[model samples]
Target chain A: MRSLPPLSIFVFALSLLIACSHEQDATAGSPGAVDVTAAWARPSLPPHENSAAFFVVHNRTDHAVQLLGASTSRAGVTELHHMEMDGDRMRMRRVPSFTIPAHGELVLEPGSNHLMFFELPAPWVDGEKVDLHLEFDSLPAVDVLAEVRPL
Target chain B: MKWACLGLLLVSLGCSDSDAGLLDFQGIGGDFTLTDEQGQKFSLAEHRGQVYLLFFGFTHCPDVCPTTLVELQEVFQRLGGAGQDLQILFVSVDPERDTPELLASYLQPFDLPVIGLTGTVSQVEKVAQAYGAFFEKVALDSAAVYTMDHSTRSYLIDGEGKVRYIFRYKDEPERIAQIVRKLLP
Candidate 1:
């Protein structure tokens, strides 16, 4: 087998190190026993209306975790909601709570389920991070940062 | 055995007739008259030679509506020069709050030539019925704070003013562009 050149080997090792660090950064900031990742919100044109945020909640512990609710200072009120198709119409319904099963993950995504922020006081600035407080039944609140981007 | 052969022959005939490349969407939509964002009288017949993508939504929809529009914007970009022949029409289901001026401003940020249309409740209902779209006003505890529940599907109309395909909100935007390019003469 032919050995890779010294310059090529150095570059390959550097890239591997960068990839590992990025993976660590993604899973680094977990509050308590829950791991939240890929949190993002769709940017709203006129801030006064409602908007949505999406993320994934992973339960690293053996016990089941229930997402009771969520809150944000930017909106007057925030609610847990999901979209359902009734006939041809798509309607948004408020969900009381979402459960993160033990050793499993709950994904909040677009066109399915999301965190609806109603009556936003101001428009979400592009590229800004909106701080979201996710409340659990027994665990302490987890602060997830959702980056606002144009949909 | 005779009846089975007859049934097979009938199925073949049905498949061949719908292979005309228009997808057998004959009765889904028809011509309608409405007012555009500029308060001008608009008719479906006027846009007969241009392909148009139609969606039913409201200005206040924070999640699905805007998300779909933004995706459409990417579709426009992917179409490149061919996009000039494509028209995006946003029909407001909540006519009470989606006025001409409001619709104009609400669609400005998408950076696409999105025409907003709203009419009287009955007028809008007629158009929605033509496309088999659903929209209903859901009143909350407070009368002033309410939202509309509407369908998130978009219709792809060919240049000859024929509804050829239906794109659900989850459909990939590139797939929509591909269908439109094939339909564009």
Candidate 2:
């Protein structure tokens, strides 16, 4: 077997290093790297056509991430919303995106940020699971199943 | 002089017995009439003898309002038999959307004894102002079109139809029930 030249060996080693670093970058920023936990949604009652879902998004990466929006088959439209207290008044504002800090978590809980589902085809019965497709700014879309709970 | 002192002591004792541990919100609430979920007139004076949890919110409110209702349901559960004497008056700030039937159906799922109330915009505004509650309609860019930004305080009215305690948002249900229990007969 013939051995390669010194320059060829150097090029091969450089390519291998680049490939390994690219793999690390892909793994670090993958959708699975971000953790979405404690996902749950309130049941929608009839004549009350809307409901909300809450969860905690843990961004394990060193870089911050943005949750742009979410979608579910159960509702006609979904939007990001935040409930804030403006001098004792509860103001529900439509938010464009929510940021999950690096190595930190964003809690979308009751009386805070939430995903509002509007125009529900039917009531979200208890014990059912809502499949949510969450779109992000830098990561691939993450799909989570939120359990419907009666408030 | 001794008789006067004794009479003064008796009056103070009577006052303490009736008003002790309750906050004085004397000028905050009064009698106001609005349309009930049954499409009939409902005046606060009619519920004078009953303890009431008065909350201003709309049915389209997905977060705070529903959570408040659920907390109230827990409050009622904690009250047990006394819960019967405790009534909840849910006044919708969004009068245009929360009609009588919608308000009725919106409350059916909670199972709480709530008298859902809605009326003309001016009527709701009058009652809200009377209780020192504030609300405004904001147009949204989303499919919801409009949402009401309203006060989240739940007024605890005693049997005399006077505001006794104002519960801040997310106040524990147990605490509310304990207070309501004290106001009950």
Candidate 3:
């Protein structure tokens, strides 16, 4: 597919806005049995469109844990999606389950495991926070913040 | 002799430590095979000695894809003629609509040597999975136009074909350019 390139100056401004908002944690993230944080909304999307919330999930337990499901009020439904391909096709599947083994971590960034909002309840007025109710096997379900970016 | 052996063991372990979260376990960069807009086959192995910026999205992407690529072009231009060996690849996550001919024409306007790639639905899926990129086709029953929602990211591959960095779609151009400059020949 193709798109007309945007002007260089607007690109610069957009880059600057994002640079201030994004933070990378190579060492440690949310301190909980099942950790999650760094959530952000897709800035360019409209209300009717699907949006993804990116974050990092870490499991510090001795036994493996699974991310069974997710719930969010901001959107009608949320699911744990893993990126998969049959051959030349790239599609995100709502996995039956995903395991974060003992002492292991899952980074739900742009490309990996992330929360998918199938149908947003309303147009994301940039900067609003959407809450995701995270579900895990043994860990108590917790709510995480997803910051909406101005489109 | 015991002291010397302890030093050697510690050094070996230290050298072995690297970020495990980002790369796959095989120790090889994820495997991918797709056709370029010019009807030419392209693979990561073919560009082992040069740095490349990669973006995975459909040709019809309305926002993130174009925004990310333009920033990359700015970085490439900032690098001047030194970016000649550096490749910028756009892999179409939506194969149903993106053909080689469409991809070729899509990249014609860009100042850089940008190659647009597309393959069968399954073929492109494999490519996206290999890079850890995610995409989903949005179905619209009423509207003629639909969109493929995808990861808004660009991966930076070093000369050795290792994915060294995954730049956020909104990262600063100068920081991206700095990383490219260090990897450039």
Candidate 4:
């Protein structure tokens, strides 16, 4: 078997070092990298009705994470809901959990996956904020503020 | 794939119909009288010379209804001067909760003059059937809480009050605007 030239061996070793350091830096720099962004809810048009909230969950960690569920004080029941397409019909149902892949994002937005609040005591008026508690597996629950905007 | 190809063919033909300044649409909608947002009698025949978009929804709808109306508003804004000739009729399927006052307040965010219409359950059902739409009251639990499960399609009616196009809920505003501009005088 032929051996690599000295110069080529040095270059290969240097490249490997650089690549490994970059990955280490990426993982070490981002601790508990589940980020919640753009949290907002659509104002309940009529009081005591169901309302929906939207947000983007970005996981920068090197391992997958599961969004177990959510809670809110403004409504009697808060559940994770997903919109399903059956043939041409669109339907919504409660989902037990959602997964966010390592270094990926899970977006909960209008007409897709969303957090549904049911039987709100009062309408989530525009310009007001709702307190949200997001639970995940093996991580501290995240307390978030979601603003309400008129649809 | 075959249906997609056929749809493309129909779209091309629709484009030609637009160019001809006459939409050779199979007649679908007819005159119906309902109470408007102002609690006054509204007759479809009265708007004979204007183009209009019609949708079936209620005040309590969270996702689909609001999204569709906002998209239609975008289409109307895109039409600019021609938009003035376009009227929007939003018929409430849940007549019990969607009074004229509720409808007016629910639609305030759009900042457009979208007329809200509602009537007796059978009256609304008859009109929805005529437009090839579906709606039902879905009971959620034993507490008597209910939600409406309804179709999300919007109908485009021309100056002659003939249904010219049925826009899907996901249709882009620009795409609907293009067709509406073609139908407009």
iRMSD per model? Answer: 2.9, 1.0, 9.1, 3.1
CAPRI quality band, candidate 2: medium
Mind giving the per-residue lDDT tens digits that candidate 3 earns over B29-140?
A: 3546788888888877776677778888765553455456667778887888888878888989878877888776656645677888887889888777777777887664
TM-score leader: 2
User: Lowest-scoring 10 consecutive residues by lDDT in candidate 1 chain A?
Assistant: A23-32
lDDT of each: 0.82, 0.88, 0.68, 0.80
TM-score of each: 0.80, 0.87, 0.48, 0.75
CAPRI-style quality class for the chain A–B interface of candidate 1:
acceptable
| Candidate 1 structure quality by residue, lDDT tens digits, B1-185 | 99999988655334334434345364577788888999998898987788889999998775778878889988988888888888898999999988988888888887887899999999999999998898888865421267789988898887677777778887788888887776665
DockQ of each: 0.29, 0.71, 0.03, 0.20
Those runs of model 4 whose alpha carbons end farther than 4 Å from true positions after fitting are A1-33, A46-48, A59-66, A85-88, A101-104, A119-128, A149-151, B1-23, B141-144
lDDT of 3 by residue, A57-134 (tens): 778777788788787887776666665434433444456667888889777765456666666667665678888887
What is the TM-score of model 2 when looking only at chain B? Answer: 0.88
- TM-score of the B chain in model 1? 0.87
lDDT tens digits, residue span A1-151, model 4: 9999999999999999999988866644445578898999987764347889999998877788889989899988887877754543556556788999988999999988989887788878889999999998856677889999865
Return the TM-score for chain B, candidate 4: 0.85
Q: Encode model 2's per-residue lDDT on A1-151: one tens digit a residue.
A: 9999999999999999999988866754754668899999989866747889999999988889999999999999999999888778888889999999999999998888999999999889899999999988877788999999876
Better of 1 and 4 by lDDT: 1
In model 4, what is the error at residue A143, expressed in angstroms? 1.2
User: Which ten-residue region of model 4 chain B has the weakest summed lDDT?
Assistant: B18-27
Candidate 2 C-alpha error for residue B31, in Å: 0.7
